[model samples]
Target: MELKKRIEKFKTREFETNKEFYLGIEKGQNPHTLFIGCSDSRVNAEILFQARAGELFQIRNVANIVPRDDDPDNNLSVVSALEYAVKVLKVKNIIVCGHSNCGGCAAIRKLNDYKDDLPNTAEWISQSSRISDYIDGKYPDMNEDNKLVLLEKLNAVRQLDNLLTYDFIRQAFDSRKLNLQAYYYDIGTGDISIYDYENEFSDLIKEIALS
Candidate 1:
């Protein structure tokens, strides 16, 4: 069967299983968390968190990156979403989540020749250029596995910094109205490591959980 026909069949049957939950959500959505995840199909926030629809306001992008706004116009979508989530939606926390074995991370290192065909996607993900600089001479001879780990961790920190650049986000954080977090999901190990900005990407998941 065609993909659209398969999708239509699922849409027809989905209502019976999920309509009640979705109906109540239409009344209003008051999600407490804004989950920033990757565009990777493998990373499903709902399933990973065991959350229902409307429980998370999700923003997805290449390498799960959120751009810093030297000018908000430079990143209108990222800035606008942060404005709504922090000022209007009042989400308590924002999560910048990255995962292992990410194609976006790999694509950054190998500036493949798809530039002719997929020029826009190539340019869009170039926001991740920092990853290349960070891993430059440091991993010149490192294996692919090690390179990906470095990419995953660096991307998370880069995005965390980007998340902080917005005034609304900074104000919310300073006023204690919001919290930000970064995590790397390891596909091979099914383990998640939280990156600490303070101790230089130190693991503080345990200490933070105490709060």
Candidate 2:
């Protein structure tokens, strides 16, 4: 297709224009922080964090899941990356960031809609069914924006709990060698909110803020 061909040509041109910029990344990257976030194009952690190349080691997944340890095939890649970042790279911080209006989070709301066709996704999203219920009851009378905000907060906590199932994460936490943080990005306002582990379902809109 002409559109696909144009994209390839644009990529080549971009590389030629930014050759040195990309080449600096050739030797290696030693990011201080590990960012685990969504695969959503709009929720780019680099852009949100104002992180330049080599400043962030980013791990992205559907629904921003850091699955339990028992899931070898799924958890292996994340675990490997985590181990490399923590043990080898010795990164000081790891952040799990979810976002508002997530299709994955919204899927829990319409589980029955995909009940017959999307078996795997249904099961996968069921991890946050409690999130669905929480959002459901919290914002039943609120607007769509409010409902999405509620889901965003709940998703962060749920994913953080999922991360705790990993031995490496718990070890890191227990040893106080690393700080694990949960966050949510509001695409509508281009704002980030960090999770306060103490205050359930509350976003640290001010204290954990970044420009």
Candidate 3:
């Protein structure tokens, strides 16, 4: 009932008031950025960036994972969108955003436990299992809670490296035609930390990529 009312309100109020703006974009969308964000309800890209319709293209998935170009089990859905965003839409920026307390990241931590139940999810997030392993191996003394937080942040940043594996993306980035960034959104604190493609994890991500 509440959901229906909200839809009704949009039709009667917000939509009607923004009819011109909406109709102007009906012909086509020219988004400036491709926002790859986690499928977390709290991490609303539009709300966070204060962007309106037709301004941002989005690809939301568990843990905001971006499969490497040469990944054996390539995720067609994500890669297709990425290709379209860059080649077709010509988006200038791509932001991969991950959030705190992500269920996907948490699942990656306990992936074996879900292998019998959520097999697909387990496999999907397994791409970032290397990040978890790195965290554990490097910070063996860190508590689980802190480890989870670090994992979430690092996982977000790692996707930037994955994005660069594509030749087209790399060409655009090197030519300064496209900008790549990773964002860690803390829902509780309403804070967002932005990371560049070449970050503190550059060396580590390079080692992992090569390995």
Candidate 4:
């Protein structure tokens, strides 16, 4: 019911029934995947993937954005986490997942509308400040709703592109030790579309099957 109650329940369950799993995680986390997802409350990466503890190294940020390596001030925490996950943790795969009706993406569509109170948030999503210009020029005939949907998907691809900027990630990828994926989740329909950097989005499929 209440947040505290839920936490207490988890504590009891952890020591009572899930003790072994918790104990194993306490020893060390050896997550096989790195999940970069949105800060949206409804988008829980572990729940969506049905992942257990220590299975994923997760980072949540506005719209699942991955700041370019050249931009140090944009998202330093993300960069640090990524470096740890790749260079130290040696996570084999990384996923940048975006979701439908994302408030961050919506804010991108209307950056100028924010008040002074949201200065930090506005600055954080500066990567999408000029998104309107792109959408207008690229899809002049597309409506607002469709444009936002396209923007969300494009942002996912953009994050994957950003991941390539990191030297460790690039080296791992080149050596076939690491893989990257872009995913778009439709909150309304509960469908997730995976994007290949080269082609369009499609239903979930094995990475090796993509061409």
Best by TM-score: 3
Q: Who wins the lDDT comparison?
A: 3
Model 4: residues with Cα > 4 Å off, grouped in runs = 72-74, 201-211
Which model, 2 or 4, shows the larger lDDT? Answer: 4
Full ranking by TM-score: 3, 4, 1, 2
List the RMSD of every prediction in angstroms: 5.3, 5.7, 1.1, 5.0
Residue 156, candidate 2: Cα error in Å is: 1.2
lDDT of 2 by residue, 150-192 (tens): 6667677666666666777778877988777888887888878
Model 3 poorest ten-residue lDDT run: 202-211
Stronger candidate by lDDT (2 vs 3): 3
Query: Any idea how many clashes model 3 has?
Result: 0
Q: Rank the models by lDDT, top first.
A: 3, 4, 1, 2
- Tell me how many clashing residue pairs each candidate has: 0, 0, 0, 0
Candidate 1 or 2, higher lDDT? Answer: 1
Q: C-alpha displacement of 101 in model 1, angstroms? A: 1.3
- What TM-score fits each model? 0.82, 0.75, 0.96, 0.90
Expressed as tens digits, the lDDT of each residue in 1-211 for candidate 4 is: 9999998988887666988778878979899999999999999888889999889999998888888788757577998899999999999899989899989988888887764768888888877555545666767999999988887887787777678878889999889899888889998999999886556633211121231
The true-versus-predicted C-alpha distance at residue 55 of model 3, in Å, is 0.9
